[model samples]
Target chain A: DAGVTQSPTHLIKTRGQQVTLRCSPKSGHDTVSWYQQALGQGPQFIFQYYEEEERQRGNFPDRFSGHQFPNYSSELNVNALLLGDSALYLCASSQTGHYGEQYFGPGTRLTVT
Target chain B: DQQVKQNSPSLSVQEGRISILNCDYTNSMFDYFLWYKKYPAEGPTFLISISSIKDKNEDGRFTVFLNKSAKHLSLHIVPSQPGDSAVYFCAASEGGAYNTDKLIFGTGTRLQVFP
Candidate 1:
């Protein structure tokens, strides 16, 4: 049984440019959420997607958006990235309506230069 | 404001000794608390959880204690091993509240188990 999987283990982006990170939830899971973990900081919730629609979002700005495909996979899009955007982007998955006990992915390390 | 707080930034324990990491929250609305263990450059793995209805929950070598009145919780690891050295984060969720799966996390405490 494969756990949650994320793409592009590591990435480097320039300021003012946009980047996309992908995630495939753990098997038998239907919900996916994104989080940002800055250096020496805990993971902060970004947003959650359920039933192919964004269910809830955190305090993040609109520049941080996400999409959930029918396959229970999700993508996090950060537009016009800034140096502050450099962090580890984590993806977690859980069963619908049962949001707790989310299994996390390895996460993508995004370096915004 | 940090709803969930892990006051200790780091903790060191001798291998085979007990490790008690503490966490406190300001929000009474939090109904569920969880403990996660994370290694370097990797995502946090769920360790143990306790619901507001219960005061304690134990899984294998991990045990979570919740004190509703004090709005505090703690994770106890018995016979700590060197592999247990990592950052431990405390998370709480108001499951039935406004947000969907909004888990407020503490800054985390780095646990070093010395052998």
Candidate 2:
């Protein structure tokens, strides 16, 4: 079975630009969550999507948004990117009932120039 | 504010020894805790976890201990091997029925196992 997958292994974006990263959850999983890992730090929660609707969010600002398709794939969009936005964006998937464990993808590295 | 904290930024242990990585959280509502291991250029992989109901959970050579009163948790790896060297992160989430609860993570601790 295929695990969680993310597109565009690495990306470079200029300030004031916009970027969209994609994610495909693991097979048999329905929930998708996004996280941002800055240099030398652990990942911080961005938001989670279930049933094509956003269910939970973290302390991030409005510049960050996400979407989940019917097939359980997800997209994370960041607008007006800043240098601080440069980080590794990770995607995780898990079943709705099983809240404790989440399988993570290799993540997309976003470097804001 | 960082709800979860891993004070030790790095640790070095000799092979075949026990390695203990510690984590502390300030949120009392956090009942679920997890540990993840990550290599360079890779997403973190779940290592082990413990719920508030259990003080300890073990899986093979990996074990996790939870101290609810102190708001602390730890991951123990026995007979550490060189391959076990990686960055370890501690994450916690509040009680919730769905999988939407956001996880608070620590800064991370790097473990270097020497042969």
Candidate 3:
């Protein structure tokens, strides 16, 4: 069985540009969530998608958004990127009614130049 | 504000020693807590977790203790091995029934176990 997978292992974007990172959740899981891990810090929650609709969000600003397809894959989009946006973007998946522990992907490293 | 904090940035211990990593949270609403370990260039891997209702949870060689009144949690790794050397993180969530349990994580503590 395949675990959660993410695309574009590493990426570089210029300031003011836009970037989209992709994620495929673990098999048999339905919920997808995104997180940002800055240098020397733990990951901060971005948002979560369930049933193709956003269900929960963190303290991030509007520049961050996400989408979940019917197949349970997800995409995280960041617009008007800033240097501070440079970080490791992680994707996590879990079953809706489980104990709430999530399985995570290796993550996409986004470096805003 | 950082709701979760791991004050220790790094720790080193001889092999076979007990390693204790601590975490504190400011949010009382957080009921479910988890510990994760990460190697360079990898995502955080879930280690063990505890719910607010429970004070302790254990797995083979790994245990997590929760102090709800003090808003503190700790991960204990007994007889630590060199392979266990990695960055450890503490995460918390509200654990709602229907909503996704979004985690709030700590800065992380790097552990190095030497033989």
Q: Pick the candidate with the highest DockQ.
A: 2
Interface RMSD of 2: 2.0
TM-score of chain B of 2: 0.95
What fraction of the true interface does each of the listed models get right, in terms of native contacts kept? Answer: 0.48, 0.70, 0.62
lDDT of 2 by residue, B1-115 (tens): 8899999999999999999999999988898888999999888998887888999999988999999889999999998999999999999988543445777889999999999
Candidate DockQ values, in order, are 0.51, 0.67, 0.63
Residue-pair clashes, model 3:
0
Q: What's the best-to-worst order under lDDT?
A: 3, 2, 1
> Model 1 over residues B1-115: C-alpha lDDT tens digits?
8899999999999999999999999999889888889998789998888889999999888999999999999999998999999999999998842224767899999999999
Better of 1 and 2 by lDDT: 2
In candidate 3 the C-alpha lDDT for residue B70 amounts to 92
lDDT of candidate 2 over A11-110, digit per residue (tens): 9999999999999999999999999999999999999999999998988999999999999999999999999999999999989876558889999999
Q: TM-score of every model?
A: 0.96, 0.97, 0.97
| Stretches of model 2 off by over 4 angstroms after superposition | B96-100
After best superposition, candidate 2 residue B84: deviation in angstroms? 0.4
Residue pairs with backbone atoms closer than 3 Å in model 1 (clashes): none
At residue B3, candidate 2 shows an lDDT of 95
Residue B52 error, candidate 2, Å:
0.4
User: For model 3, how does the per-residue alpha-carbon lDDT over B48-99 read when each residue is reduced to its tens digit?
Assistant: 8888889899999999999988999999999899999999999988884333
